[model samples]
Target: MKKLVLSSLIGLCGLSLSAQNVLIGEGSLLRGRGYCEPSISINPRNPDNIVAGAVLDAVFYSTDGGESWIADTMVSSFGVWGDPVLITDTAGHHYYLHLSDPTGENWSSEEILDRIVIQKSTDGGQSWSNGTFTGMAHPKDQDKHWAIVDTSTNAIYITWTQFDDYGSENPEDESNILFSKSLDGGETWSEAIQVNTIPGNCLDNDSTTEGAVPAVGPDGTIYVSWGNRGNLYFSKSTDAGESWTEDKVIAQQPGGWDIDVPGVQRANGMPVTICDRKGRLYVNWVDDREGNYDVWVMHSDDGGENWTDPIRVNDDTGSADQFFTWMCVDPVTNILYAVFYDRRGLEGNHTHVYQARSTDQGESWTNIRITEESFRTNPLVFFGDYNHISAYGGRVRPIWTRIQGLKMGVWTSLWEESRYEGEKD
Candidate 1:
């Protein structure tokens, strides 16, 4: 693998621009337990305090605006398996959610993935509770869960995919999206309810319904979107999670959610939904509709009733692959930011991390390369599903996975919007 600094790329232009890269955790080759699929959240109350989580049971925290981090492992009675999702409430309380493995037997026991587990942290990510769970319908599997906090009421809402029998080829097995909420912090949760009208098979592929991410509108309305079959579906709850509208198709995902990228073990173009303070809803995903994988976004102003045409996010002119994309709308500034693995000017399996910023409500974008070096990946290694970005005020933190040889590590870049005020392409 070739290692090059960001400053080296900018030297040709006689300009200096760089974002500080911080490594949170690294994994060894033993049993292939390297960390990936990282999630991050910045405290709304204090931008300096941040928390992050990676696959399996790793947790990290930074108090000085992501300059340094403290890493630790998380435990729960229900068992922390994978698919880590982290979010912080308005009151600065952080929550870590993941799939459960009750018997610790992994795939050998049917008890694995019987439910979804959520643990709360009051004092940042230093410590966590044993965890409380929802969607505990045994004999079934719950996976691909994501959550968001309603700043108005401090309530937590989550959405995920449930399977009758995971990885089952039987035609009788099915898959659906489920919704749940916690009104009184993490102490209790509402009963999980079915939200998707059409069900998919249990194959966990393009036909399987997945990627139900929830976003809150300015008027307190809840909106969710997912990819099923070859279309992206949308649904909303005007009265919170108690009720939901019938599922509606918003866009066509030509290649579906399951995507093919070289040097990646497995990848998906799952939709990530977010809303700005002005009630403008945005859904971002990746697909190969143009003969190669690219990041795209669609926005709805009337709360999912109508949506704009798919807007390509990458600025490169040639065909290249961009996968594992994530987006975030700054609550204070409403500026849109997206992060993804980019192969714009590189050949073969070489990849670098890039972020796009849109200040005019997705009308146009400016791309910035945030990674200090590019790394090559091997398709045999198990690279996790997704990467995450969180922005509060002007502070932006993008977390991603990097593979060097046989070792994998989780990293974040200390990025602030003001740093590149006069930067040019």
Candidate 2:
């Protein structure tokens, strides 16, 4: 039997759940003082085999449906400098993608930030090859990348922000959304193609176009969305990224993607794009549209051509900050799940992890607190930019970073949806 914890944690709303939370990473091997920006993926072919990756150099995998995990260090010839993204192809091959740092330095030279590297592992992320790369332009920096594989064709599509000069304030320096793909497993990739029509300045602020996550529709159409200048923009390609439609402004991000939150060095509400199995599109992000920062979501049934108004995903009516959201949809069931940092029950800088589920599309939602305890966040440390979640076969895993006693760790809850049989939606 499982224990259920019920409480009024979500402001005036009572939250109840039976989540088996698990600590995935800790101790000396986690490296440095902090670990954030985690990525996780569930094998559609074998849901028991789940893989996860984290910033700097960390990879964790489980063969028994996350009952336990094996922590491993990730290394690549291109160098792993954070922004770890993991994905699996139709053939059960897992790939770890991150920004390249050839010299292991802090991107002191142009070549260090010249490419986005990807490493392949055939044996369920046990080992990874040296890796391949795309967008190897000199002096240009590639960051904040995400990938998706079309199970039907085994094609891998990746999208990211390509910077002319990372963190440059010069007017000549610019940033734009770029797309590339690999037709054959992970052997090679096509040349990088610019997907966005409007170029943003390279100030690394709200104006900078970043966070381009790609999703494939039922008919193989590619859809992407990103944040820029207090608004969310979207574009799509029908020919496997050969071309793209002109960008369209989808939603308003009132306070922009970057925001200020107490007890954190930096926080971003960048958009995460996902498409369900039926060709419906959904985009999720955080913003201070209300009195405080909250996770917001929008959906489109027709395609990327239209979108519904922003709906608050967090159930709290209190003025608390909720940021760093990442969303995923179960392809088989079409249920939507989002994970983010929540401060609804805290008095100050303390934070907890919360998840919002929408089974009737975006019409209704239920908020649940997944963390057993709250931890204090420190502004002196970098909390990273985003958290990740992956769900399939009713096995949902939400990965996030936390700080306690000045040490940083990453964790996930082995939340099996079967616990609440008739309570779904």
lDDT of each: 0.89, 0.85
Candidate 2 TM-score over all chains jointly = 0.94
Candidate 1: residue 321 lDDT (0-100): 90
Q: Tell me the tens digit of each residue's lDDT in model 2 across 298-382.
A: 8998887778998889999799889889999887777889999999969889998998898988777888888878898888787
Which parts of model 1 have CA positions greater than 4 angstroms off? Answer: 1-15, 422-425
RMSD to native for every prediction? 4.0, 5.0
TM-score versus the correct structure, for each prediction: 0.95, 0.94
List, in order, the clash count of every candidate structure.
Answer: 0, 0
Task: Name the weakest run of 10 consecutive residues (lDDT summed) in model 2.
Answer: 3-12
Report clash pairs, candidate 1: none
